[model samples]
Target: MKRPKFFYLIAGFFILAIFLAGCAGQKGNEQGKSAGHPNVLKANWQDVLSQAKGQTVNIYLYGGSESTNNYIDNWVAPRLKKQFGVQLNRVPVNDTKDIINKLVSEKQAGKKDGSIDVMWINGENFLMSKKNNLLWDSFSPKLPNVKKYVNQNSPAIKNDFGEPTQGVEAPWSQAQFVFTYDSNKVKHPPKSAEALKQWVKQHPGKFTYPAPPDFTGSAFIRNMLYETTGGYKQYLKPLDKQTGLDNIVKALWNYLNAIEPYLWRKGETYPESASKLDQLYASGAVWLTMGYDPAHAANEVKDGRFPKSTRTFVLKDGTLSNTSYLSIPFNSPHKAAAMVAINFMLSPKAQIAKSDPENWGALMAIDPNKLSSKGQKQLNAIDRGKATLPSKVLANHRVPEIPAGYVDYLEKGWMEHVAKH
Candidate 1:
């Protein structure tokens, strides 16, 4: 009897231990096993949007163009106010390089918060900012507006000028190489690089590009390299030190050298900047000029900056096109507001409004199909210019691009070349 009783007691003890073990396993799952996760806060976009509703966001942008400044002030800013109660104060700078320098200084000073809210950046500036850890972390996936409204396939979303975005910046517009000519000045326009050089020679002091490091100047060099190299496959890759400069591009340099003597002001001087070149074009100092904005002439004409006789065109080869994006500083105090503003910019309504020629005249940053039916109609209405080149024009065009690696090296080489002569 005593042995049987002891056996029963042992069975009960084992059962209790098993039950407790199961309970312990259940508790572990409920609490979650990760040591670093506190599970204290919920990642919520609604909360962020609410917090940002009335906040002020300071945006730093390239202020080189008067028309752009006016558009931002007259159109984009007021809408942000009427909708979100957010106030935007634009900090205009002549050079984006200065903004980077300021950001670097702020970071070094240990001023972590309440610095800059948003930045308008692309190309070399975007790459350098991302490399230096100046930009804010990825907030794109967290925004409802981004998930539902933004066009994921647009070049703006792909990354600007071949640089990866990593969701650190929101895309705003599409820009392509646009060559504008005044019909009064030239009855026949050069359709190829070789022809352009000949035209420059035939009409000395009629053509010029911005100096190196400038957006247009750098792009022009890249375009020339692309054409002369015969293809852009190798250039689209990272530039290597071994072949830092391609001998194939010698033709481009030769061509440019030959035309420098005939360039505007004898190529001893340039228009100082891309905007100045546009001004030169408008003032009839130069018969032709290059623009990244295809509809730039339309805007200029609408605003009385360019005559109606001016027309825009692209080379037979489609132009090297890209997008511009907005980024936030790593230490932005109003990050939520910045993200909200970006989402709003990406929204269909705001995007359509921005697309209007009378407003911002910016190209849409979304796919037309994804846009609301209403948005699609708005896009169609605003995209008024001839968007394609004729077959004959296409044959003369070259898809020129600079290898990311060659950008700095080429700029340096070009500077040296300029200095020696």
Candidate 2:
């Protein structure tokens, strides 16, 4: 049974190779399954706070607005670091969808350790993340600010598009669609879709909108659709429940084409995005530029990006409005820090700064009435700048957003009906 010396040496070498291969495989498997386990659930606020200190949290958001970038970078980051000993890193993205996509990839690769601590997501992007189970568990209810300042039962707080948030995301800001025009150039701004069409024809080559798929352009269609087909009430329900969708959408197409001929370049092309259109308006190449943010013109004016004469208006019929939110990713390694950051952002102090025109001029998501008399006084004193409308004016013209499903449908439909046509 004894083997030759050379034979035994060869056998030992083969066994050693198998052992090395097994070790390498195990190491690879571990990396592939590197899950983020911040484990903030079942912990008290104090415990979470203690754990969060000295941690760095990354917040991913659309970086289109320089004011927003500065607000978070300068105003918010310092406060978070000073108060909680936590570092807030800003990870500006071109699209919020990219965060969901990144999380989805991480999940597929069995990577539990993900980089996105929090994301500024809403509407269709939130719907997609929820559908794919790309978000972390119910964590918002754990925050003291949510319990104190937020109305838990309001439909606006409960839902994102049509999907229930169920304590997964925290409401951060409110946005309403508004058209920005140079007051010196636009004597009488359009009040409705028909009026807008007439104005476009009269002032040929003086107006243009960002192409559809751009957030601002997509919103323009949705606002006009409300005026043309009826109002937003019909679209409040789920997409499947609504009927005669095709015929209803046809009216929107006609309205768009009618105005297209009078667009800045004769409808042969469009500004690639809202920012591009803003640049055009700033330079007086176009008379109008529009955005979902009511205070956007004010911020632009403060930054000298838009003319001092720029003013904002919503369609007399109605203006589309919705809430944007922050949520932790499913595999975020800094769950405690993420929760702390979100809670702080929801606090009255942070919201007031966000609402200030000098900072970002974003609408406060916090229910202002929920604050005490002193808190209310502080909030009321923040002048939202001249180009921004009063709260009552924006709220009076405000209309609810359609279900996210409908948003997707229109984005695709625009390509077929309007963009190509």
For 305-376, candidate 1 gives per-residue lDDT tens digits of 876778767755456766677888877777777877777777888777776666666666655568877767
Cα TM-score of candidate 2: 0.91
The lDDT per prediction is: 0.72, 0.88
**Predicted structure 1: clash tally:** 5
Residue pairs clashing in model 2 are 34-112, 35-112, 36-112, 36-113
For model 2, residues 101-164, the per-residue Cα lDDT tens digits are: 8988999998868898999999999999999999898998889999999987888788887788
| Segments in model 1 whose C-alpha atoms lie over 4 Å from true places | 1-42, 151-156, 241-244, 383-403
Against the true structure, what is every candidate's RMSD? 9.2, 5.4
For model 1, the local distance difference test gives 0.72
